[model samples]
Target: MDLHPIEIVGRHPGPKILILAGIHGDEYEPIAAVRRLAGQIDREQLTGKVTLVPIANHSAYLRHSRVGTDQLDLARTFPGSADGTPTQQVAHAITGLIQQSDLMIDLHTGGLAMEISPLVGYMLVSDPSTLQKQRQMATAFGLPIVWGTTASLPGRSLSAARDANVPAIYAEWGGGGGCQAAGVAAYTAGCLQVMAQCEMLPSPAAAAPVDRCVIEDDRDTSGHLQLNYPAPHAGFYEPTLPLDSTVRPGDELGRLHDPFTSHTTTIYSTQTGRLFTRRVLPPVEAGDCLAVILEDPAETGTTNE
Candidate 1:
């Protein structure tokens, strides 16, 4: 794996903030955003050090696939072993980078299957102070939504960061396996805001605070958030609602049509929330995620409940 680091150190020593993108090869917006930032940021104007890894998974990136040549997901192989697969070795190297940084931002998108709303996510850690720091960084990203989740999927970059006691935020926007101009613009602006908040760059007028929500999945019975809406069977999907649409329980989200048999299955929302992600591509296989429903903060009675 070829790892390239774009480092900009200020005249005065300060915090070291690491920005990462393209962990999933098909997610193009963040890759574009970081590349733009790499060229646009003036090292002389920076107060601290900023290191950007525009493409983290080189093999997958080359193939335009989410998984590496071995079919292992790079994001799910964090803190990997030295004698493991190529993806795992890459993960190990990235974890090393994470350990040396004061703060981190992992950029992501919906990848090949879906399009996502602009949002930032911070893991809920055991330490209150660390959790607060993560939240502050998420807020600084200036996105419309800030999601807090306690459950960290094994081997995820954020999970590895937590193990290293590093404060990190994961930002997601855009997808469908292609780059979007609006997505690139949003991510670029958000990264700059994060740098300003980290004191690496001069602060601009504060970005409007976002709507914070505690995202809980099926793992927690009391938690109402249902992150995934999967395709029931292989078919073509036609979305009924637009992205970021406020949805109520039982609202029709879309329809799955089997062209061969002319059979149509209607998909409905199981929770009251906003549609944060949706599959834009028509063709889908069984069990593919069709949409992601994030529980509405107002409906849940509190933002972080």
Candidate 2:
């Protein structure tokens, strides 16, 4: 197996925290945050070890693809085989690195399929001790949303961490397919908060507050999304609602058209809630996802109205 690439920023003899990002090439927010943290954090203040793996899948990242060249999802192949494919080797190496750390924080962001909320996901495992630590870390981050997977995801990741007896939490922020400056900052802050949690850095006074989400599945609880399109003829696409807008069932979302024929197609929402995510461009193919509707059970609040 190819040896994992780990960059140790802080000295040891204290606690150990592993910061992993770029498992998926498309998700650039986490990678960028790690880069900033590596340069910003003062080495002298660090009490333990801070290992940074900025690009876990360098091969896929270079090609700007989500999956590895072997058509494998590297994240799903943890505890991999020693003589397995290239992706599997990489996964195994990452798993080994995690085994040596006291805490693991895997950073991620929304992908092309959907734009998820700025939240941290703590995948529930069988170990109570690890679960408690995961919760503590999540709460410390102070992210607006904290989602619990309830169970470990299939394949690798949280499962491997469990097998290795390491406390790991996956924190996601911003929409991966697009760039958001504010979203990036929020994620970076959340990561920095980890230092305080591990006691590697000084904890703040009682004044440093935090938020809690009763349920992590904010999108599902909010509402269902419905896509709307008009007669279908268009030149490019233009959206009206923008992203993260709260809208009712009949609200106008955007329009599409055939560039050559100059035909216009109108799009609308079918549910009352918020616009959690939207397409970045226009002139998409038939059945292209233009926007998503996140219905709030309370029927209120949007990321950005």
Best by lDDT: 1
Error of 1 at 22 (Å): 0.7
Model 2 earns a TM-score of: 0.72
- Indicate the residue-level lDDT of 131 in model 2: 82
Residues 108-219, candidate 2: write the lDDT tens digits.
Answer: 7755544556667676666889888988888877776665554544455666777877887787665536656776676677777877888776664443455555343333
lDDT (tens digit, per residue) of candidate 1 on 1-305 = 45798888887788888899989888899889999999878888888888899999989899898888989888879988777999998998899889999899999988887888888887777777888888888888878878877645567888789998899999888778778898888788888888888788888776665665545332332111223777899999999999989998899999999979979999999878788889888998898888887774455664443
Worst 10 residues of 2 by lDDT: 217-226
Over all chains combined, what TM-score does candidate 1 have?
0.90
Please report, as a residue range, the 10-residue window in candidate 1 with the lowest summed lDDT: 217-226
How much is the lDDT of residue 247 in candidate 2? 85
Off by over 4 Å in 1: 205-227, 297-305
TM-score of each: 0.90, 0.72
lDDT of 2: 0.69
